[model samples]
Target: MNDVNVYTVTRLTRDIRLVLEDTFQAVWVEGEVSNFTVSSAGHTYFSLKDESSLLNCVMFRGNSGRVGFTVKDGMQVLCYGRVSVYDKRGQYQLYATKMEPRGKGALQLAFEQLKEKLYKEGLFDEANKKPLPFLPMHLGVITSATGAAVRDILKVARRRFTNIKISIYPVRVQGDEAKHEIARAIEELNEYNRHIAETGGEYPVDVIIVGRGGGSLEDLWPFNEEIVAREIYASEIPVVSAVGHEIDYTISDFVADLRAPTPSAAAELVIPLKHDLTVRINEYRDRLYLSIKTKTEMLEKAVKTSRDRYVLRAPMNVFLQMRQQVDDLLRTAVSGISHSLELKQRDLGTVTGKLQALSPLAVLERGYSITFKDGRIVRDAGLLEEGDILHSRLSLGRVTSRVEHVG
Candidate 1:
């Protein structure tokens, strides 16, 4: 009993924490995530467990940011952390620094997660896409300047169209910092376009080629980044994503306005064949010339037919005929006017004869007189009254008198 030493609880807990951490420093654990939760302080707490065993894990705020994925319940994960005991709870737990989904590549999982996020935000919608110019005068290319992608694209573009202009925006296509470079290249090129528009310049880059040659998924990861996808979406110029061979695709492919199978294909699509354009233009010219010739021939034939008419062949004779028609119209109008005046004079004479025949003057001229009493004609002897005023009208004079008797 005397040989036993007494120990405090705090000291024992601290010693256990240190010993556990030292023993399993930088351990790798693979299990299914259970009861995953993030604390208010940005620490992720979860249980990593298989069928028979369970281990508690925590990722502090500093390490959580670097995990690069959301921790969820029922997710199979591989984690790397230091094993240590939590002194307060007197329990051993894993302090994880890194974690990834099990049975899948971490970068691929990242790509999928980002893709879902952007898709929900409508970044990949067709309505948001811009159409490529049918014949772009200038094309902006964003890739490694020294890469085979640039070489293939230039060769194809030059072969397809003789007068096409290409502006190369050199950028790294892979590695940790490649995504930022690609994004900046996109923005810078867009800015250049804006500058051109503001300046009222012609032949600015009408389309952009954003891609690289075929490679492993790791090599093409920059194109799959969220920044690159958004840059392509927000660009004013149409973008063509040609990241790799036909079998491979990236997030850029989904967001770009068009996706070509290869860089060379992108070049071919941007500019049509020079020979085809020439053939089309020649066809239009030939049609126009043929139509004009046919119309001219018809007009000439019509003029010839017109000259064969008698009036057109004898121009002076036609004028003489029109003069004769005018003289005939004048003679007819004068005769009509004279006949109308004669008829009016005859009517006036007839009316005058009738008025003279009905006139009372004629009767007075024949030695007849009219007697009036009280302004009324005395047509009967009974109409006369003694001492009434009377008037007599003769052919040349009027007589005033008083009625003295009746006869």
Candidate 2:
């Protein structure tokens, strides 16, 4: 019994864990995901199951943060990790380092997920979009300076509008550092514009064009990043996204104020053709000149007609005619005054008759005599005192009498 090898539970578990981890380092496992959950600490725990068996898996936050897409139950996935055992449970599980969807690429899945997310958040609403200027004085461009995109833009700009001021902010359009660089470029350009505004400097950037030449999804991943999308959304200056060919669409395109199919198209959109502007201006000038000429010709005709008339060609005849008009007006005014005076006299006669009918003298003529004292009509006889001189008014004349009794 003493010669027999002895193994404790801890020793057995530790030996198994080391063996599994060593042999299964960086093994690739493909299966349908189930029982997936993300812990509060951001670690992901899930089970990968086949038709016959199930394997437990855990992705720490460090590795899970790098995953581009959401993982859920019932979704087929491919996981790369090393097998390890938990000492507490004595169970073997996979410690995943990387994960990807089986059918779609990681970046593509990530893009779709982020688009849905931002759309739900109202970031992609048309109401939030800024309007591009009709004619921008200065333009800001963010792209690879040495790439074909810059060349295409410059070529279009030269042909379309040569006087527009353009400032280029060179940045990488791919790789790990590309997104950061692109975001920083947008921010710096905005800051520069702000500085120009505060200082009232000339040629401040009116609009920005963020773009790149056509490339694979992998190459264009930088523009698809959420950071780039947010930066484009936050930009005060209107942003025109011109990434890749017409077929390509990135997150930046969705968030930008406008999206052009290519960099050349972006240039054509922002810069109007000088020749076309000149043609329009010439049309306007011609129309204005024609209008003025018509007005002048009308005025000249009016003046010539005035000169040909008797007024300007014969001054004495015009004066004689004016004198005759004045004499006619004077006669008309005299006739009007005589007719008005006759009408007023007739009206006055009628008014006098009406006033005479309403007068107290009319009552006196009807045999009613009014008594007056001290020039006022005596309405009450009790107001008269003895020996008071009362003037009794009759229809013909006034009689002066003395008050003898209070009757």
Candidate 3:
């Protein structure tokens, strides 16, 4: 015991770590992943197991970022790192510097994973896409300043509509920093639009075009990044993705409101030909003028026809016909009244003759007279007294005398 060396737990772990790290430094291991986990700090922890044995592995945030593809349990992967020991856990593990999927390229695997994830989150839904403006007066573009994409867009836009206003935000279209720059450009343009809308300012960007010239998948990797995809999806203004030729598609393409095959194509889609619009306006104006003229001519013809009618052309004749009808009616009324008066006169004469025949005057006129005593008619001689005064009514005169004999 005195001759042998005693090692503390820390000393043992350190010595083992140094030995393993030296023996397996910069190694490549192949295995299926299990017990995979990522910490909030972005450190990835997992176990790589072969058929017989398992090895614990750890990847810190710095190295994990370059891994390209997400690591999950049950995925077969190739890891390059050195074996090391954890002092606290007294465990030996692999500190991975790089990790890649077994059968696919790192960038491609990452693209597929992110695409599936965002698609499941509904970022690619057609309902989420905004409708592009029929005519965008102001456009916001994000691309390399000297790239062919910008030139193509400007040329096409100028040719189609000379008055369209374009505001370019130059950004790196490739490399590690491209994703951040692209995302930031989208955010700034959105903020600019919001500011203009809130303050009622002029020249608000109606649409945004994010694009680059056609290139390989690696060259276009920035647009595939989640940061750029999210910003494009959340933009207030519509985004037109013109990332590459018709054959190339990026994650940005799916999330954008519209996808154009090229930057020139994007301009063609957004801007209408000024000459065509002018022609349409002139056509509509001609149609309206023709319609009004036709209606006016029809009205004029109708008025002329009305004026040519006999009643309207000879108004005095209409009045004369009305007056003649009134005079005829008046004559008929007067003739009817005269005939009625003659008949009435004949009837009155007949009535008068009949009345005279019924009166006592007719008897007197026939030479018979009426006698009265004391104002009463003396129809009976026995009603008279010898000294009574008598009156006689003749046809011509009346006689008053004293009565002497009753018989």
Predicted structure with the largest TM-score when compared to the true one: 2
**Best candidate (score: lDDT):** 3
lDDT of candidate 1?
Answer: 0.91
Residue 292 deviation, candidate 1, in Å? 3.0
Runs in model 3 lying further than 4 Å from the true structure? 1-13, 88-90, 311-407
Every model: Cα RMSD to truth: 5.5, 4.9, 12.8
Computed on alpha carbons, the lDDT of every model, listed in order, comes to 0.91, 0.93, 0.93
Ordering by lDDT: 3, 2, 1
Instruction: After superposing candidate 1 on the true structure, give the runs of residues whose Cα lies further than 4 Å from its correct spot.
Output: 34-43, 49-54, 61-63, 307-312, 330-407
- RMSD to native, candidate 3: 12.8
Shift in Å, residue 97, candidate 2: 0.4
Tens-digit per-residue lDDT, 1-407, candidate 1: 68987668889988888888788998999999999998999998999999999999999999887665556799899999999888888889999999989998788888889889999999989999898888888889999999999999989877889798989999999898999999999899889888989999888889999999999998998898888898999998899999999999899999999999999998888879999999999999999999999999999999999989998889999899999999999999999999999999999999999999999999999999999877889889886778888899999999999878877
Model 2 RMSD in Å is 4.9
How well is each residue in 50-74 modelled by candidate 2, as lDDT tens digits?
Answer: 9999999999999999998888799
Which structure is stronger by lDDT: 1 or 2?
2
TM-score of each: 0.78, 0.81, 0.73
Candidate 3, backbone clash total: 0
Candidate 3's TM-score: 0.73
